[model samples]
Target chain A: MSEQKVDTRLWSSKARNLSPYVPGEQPQHANLCKLNTNENPFPPSPKVGEAIANVLEQQAYDLRLYPAPESDDLRASLAELYNLDINEVFVGNGSDEVLALVFASFFLKERPVLAPDISYSFYPVYAQTFGVELVQIALEDDFSIDPDAYRQPCSGIIIANPNAPTGLLLSLADIRKLASEHSNSVIVIDEAYIDFACIDETNSSTQVSAVSLINEFDNILVTQTFSKSRSLAGLRVGMAFGNASLIEALTRMKNSFNSYPLDKLAQAGATASVLDNDYFEQTRQQVIDLRKSLTTQLTTLGYQVLPSHANFVFARPKDGNASAVAAKLREQGIIVRHFDKPRIQEYLRITVGTQAQHERLIDALTAMQTYSEDSETISNMG
Target chain B: MSEQKVDTRLWSSKARNLSPYVPGEQPQHANLCKLNTNENPFPPSPKVGEAIANVLEQQAYDLRLYPAPESDDLRASLAELYNLDINEVFVGNGSDEVLALVFASFFLKERPVLAPDISYSFYPVYAQTFGVELVQIALEDDFSIDPDAYRQPCSGIIIANPNAPTGLLLSLADIRKLASEHSNSVIVIDEAYIDFACIDETNSSTQVSAVSLINEFDNILVTQTFSKSRSLAGLRVGMAFGNASLIEALTRMKNSFNSYPLDKLAQAGATASVLDNDYFEQTRQQVIDLRKSLTTQLTTLGYQVLPSHANFVFARPKDGNASAVAAKLREQGIIVRHFDKPRIQEYLRITVGTQAQHERLIDALTAMQTYSEDSETISNMG
Candidate 1:
């Protein structure tokens, strides 16, 4: 279909100038190795399907009723899992929605909010949508967030741990420092990929979650999602853990937007998935293991891979033609993400897939490398 | 849990002053006559259940993948059903979300947007959330919208057809006139309850949908939801029909906010429900018949019931104590909506439920009348 030509005269100034975030392609074909979006290459816990089926079987008639606007059951389940009071949690259709609400609730101030330049792209979209000025702090050469950069006076700060496309994890100490230094501003730690990060054995808990800081810092808001770790991307379930007041602000924004954002099936399925910790641990571990292997394999191919803590890895090819390599991979029925943005145009963000899919991707890259060598030899002979 | 005491210091100025929209109660009890929300009494088409189950059984593993960002499948289905191009339809998590996006897309202008003062209270909340200047025009003494009020120069106009809580249908001629006069501004027609309005048999189609006006008016937008006629309140699917330019603006806003607002199962189930027109017609007709009988019964009990064209009947008790009447109904396990807003404070918006539930409600009202008479006699004797 042709692109729609919107009438700028009829459009709001915000809509006319909106540069919407472009999501990764969700190709409908089944034969391709889909590693573009950072979705866990595994099915969710068996309980999720059962829970959804049960809702259909028993409460199908009750679909006529509105779901609990508060999503109390899911929030309670999340609070129980996180060892926090139910008041500390707020759930939404997805983390995107949660983040959008956070922007509206906490970031619309006279001072500009701070974020990493190359973090989750949706941050700027939300900033623009709410008319909040966002000052993006540049990531360091090694793609790590500098806590000192966020020390400046700002309205708020939003940082994605194990930041997307770069996949580098920020230390909890750094997170605490940022939160402490920016005490006046709401510090939102977007932990969307925190589940895939290596467990911090030195910490009291095995998980490297920023939720622990909520008690000490009332300004800290940790947002998470069931999409990556729990393998429920198709089901839009996201949550945030913060102080009661922060959660209350988000709740107000959510209520103002949509009272029942999470439908019955989503609530039921997400709650069941959260309850199955064993299944969650197993799948997350599998993705972590795959990420390691993929990183090693890419390193062997002379790709300078970043230290990845998420389900995806960011790597620049030694020859520095990421867009070309991505196109080549697509021709071979494999998909990987390559952003044509500044400071990262040469990097490809490849999601860690299952063993078989990884092997297929490796074979495709090997074939391309060998063909490149052959072409070079022929050019030398000529 | 106690009410959360939000720290206003930590909240944005918007969130600090935000008065969130309060949805009707969703009580957990199984036996209550839930006539509070205007939800359809019938279950969704059997096909919706089958479709959801099929998605679970077949693509359950694919839950690991993100849903199509644009919900192209559902949009295509809706376009087919409505005889519009796919680009003309925009879907969201719910009509609330759709409306929120619409406000963000088309109403955030320097000039204030106009809305009915006593209509859906959510409009004001959205205006506050988006920081849009909203001028609430007064409805007529009989609670019908005055189209002339919307003719004034404004940024936009958003009116609920067969207006909520009032259940009075504004004629398409009036809607067309509003759109025509406000040609320079975006005119949004919220048709959340339009499906429950009486079918115009004299028209080419039986349903009274303003979607027909979309082709003629580039500035007009019609929004609808599956919650009312399709009996899928718990599914959370809503759509907007407009010119491609308006639809494109909404798409930009939705993408900027959340890529996959409608989850996989929601897309599947809503599509199936839309395709099942026979079941929709049967259930909608049932609601219309039940509403007629309920209006007659309430009128007999000294209530002035408005001539309703929607799923619920708005009526006022002769004594004019709606809060007291609503409390009395709650005591009898019969819940109905009562707004404390100005101009509509005396009315109770009773949803049209099943015949059995209606009988229970009527019986409770009769018992209340009898008790009131007995109490009066006792007071007189004393």
Candidate 2:
């Protein structure tokens, strides 16, 4: 409320008018399922810790010096991983910071940018922060981002791949069409959950990245984070991949803002994460497998779950009292996200955790159902 | 140059027109005196590494989860050290990021803001980034800020205390008068080098922080960095101290921008640095002592050094060919900053390193003078 409230005396008009984005609660408590924020249930790779420790051992004294202004090591690693030129990579504190710079760099034009209404909540907040005009198009009834919905002349367009809250993927073909259609404007494909989109119909993890089309369409920019997939949320590293010119614009803006946004430890740890292919492969497949199992279990519990292609699932309970189920789960030390927003209010977003964690959740839901049936029978007898 | 070159296609109008800031070089060479960026020569507090190592040991797994959004641990330590309420402190990726948000939160108004023309160069860049109208008032003839020079109506005011490049300090009396005169406007005091200002005429760092004025003047905001004083530039920790309301606005803007700007290692390390008073005091005192000795040596070597209250000194050589001297020093693997801007083109801003490092610089400058005279004699004889 303080963010929305206007204070004329000292606060800037921009600060007073801003509706700050509220990230999911990073609760400090223990003994809960803690699936609210879409954090990977598994730990980061051992190589990440080893890389960080190596920095401390070697450069504890060099910590007095500033990090390399351009974060060359991290950018080089990201470039190698994504098969991009070094100049085409830009690294920031997180995907959030990367997107903020993107908005500042490519979207502050005369025309309004287009976004899906039921996408990442931070999109609108960024629009407000940068004073960029945003036009939000509604999703289809199935919570799928319709490629044809963005049918307007715009400065730029942004869509989250395997869109948040509702975990549904937009095909690369649709993305190519959209990028080709809007050749003059920048198209930001936020792939925060793309690593989790590996679940395909063939029981194999499919590649859904739009990075392949970056060369064909110079206007397309892809943003990804270490938080969800690499499991380095505590490290704060995010990256953007685009053509040299667009990435140059981002670098210029980044230089103007904070030249050394990625600290030394972050550069080292994230670079190691990118290089450790086997660990990344094992962990990503595990999450994908866990997601499949969780989806089947949720459907068995009579929840109308969306076909999730992300690390989280959005589901409506059998009784349609999603908030009640979430609250009941919380009472049993399990936490899930229940949005108070429009249209999707009846759905609860649950992060896919390990197998044991999913079992705990399923047991709780079964008990709740049994109790509900008993109460219904008692009420009928009365 | 690419930053200033405009490309209209696919770039935002803002990005097209941006002339981003150029930071002092963090050269990758070895065996150089390396004083260009004003980083402290010594290592950070030993406790900083311990704290970071502890985080990696304890929460290597927890790194999968997001860092605390508010960076409460770091802020609490800062508040406790500053004798302010917890809500009065704010932390960010670095002082650069903190100032960037400050510009966005407080200066984006109809009224133009005032800044010293000779202050930190990034101030203008931040102004450009946020589209804030910045009015640069020229400094005094002696390269000092005249507090009374801030004459016009303005939204806010920014001044680097013991100002950058020149290293001049404004008296607390002048600061109080300025704050009193501009009660309605927020006055930002960037104390990036304040900790090095410990050298008083009585040989002590007399309390120079405008933080002492924060409770008295609700409009005065003071920003300090771990980069210069704590020797944690690689950690990327910076903080702002102000009244709760001003800090609240900064929080709103920061939250709107990036909630987890400070990573887990940064928070833990910075907090430990604050708590380790002995390490901070010892390192700070060493820098002050080194600065004092460096000043005497430069003065003895016929350079007109300004009375520096910072970790670095601004001095003009006898011949005033700073570029020539800098070039000579570079050939011997020694580097110092030589700004080519008007009014200060003849000066070099040199960071105070260890005793031996300063001696190397003095010896090099001494050799340069002797070589110059000998070359002149040969030319004259010919």
iRMS (Å) per candidate: 1.1, 1.6
Residue-level lDDT of model 2, residues B1-382, one tens digit each, is 2534545589887887777898888788778789888999889989989999999998789999999899988888889998999988999999999999999989999999899988899999999999999999999999888887996799999999989989989877888988999999999999999887753645554788899999999889999999998999998989999888888899989989998998888889999999999988888888888888888989888889999989999999987898888888999989899988899989999998988899898888887776778886686678
Cα lDDT of model 1 by residue, B280-374, tens digit: 87788788888889999999999999988888999998888899999999987889999887777898999999899988988988777777888
Q: In model 1, which runs have C-alpha deviations exceeding 4 angstroms?
A: A1-4, A199-207, A375-382, B1-4, B199-207, B374-382
Cα lDDT listed for each candidate: 0.89, 0.89
Number of the top TM-score candidate: 2
Interface RMSD of 2: 1.6
Best by DockQ: 1
Where does model 2 exceed 4 Å of error?
A: A1-8, A199-205, A375-382, B1-7, B199-205, B375-382
TM-score quality measure for candidate 1: 0.96
Candidate 2 per-residue lDDT, tens place, A1-382, comes to 2534434578888998888898888767778788888999889889999998999998899999999888988888888888889988888999999999999999988899999999899999999999999999999988888788887999999999989989999999899989989999999999999987854544444668988888988999999999998999999999999888889899988988888898888888998999998899888888988988898999998999998888899999988898899889999889899998899989999999988899999999988887789886576578
- Per-residue CA lDDT of model 1 for A52-90, tens digit only, reads 999999989988888888888899999999899999999
Which fraction of the native contacts appears in each prediction? 0.88, 0.87
Taking the candidates one at a time, how many backbone clashes does each contain?
0, 1
lDDT of 2 at B247: 87
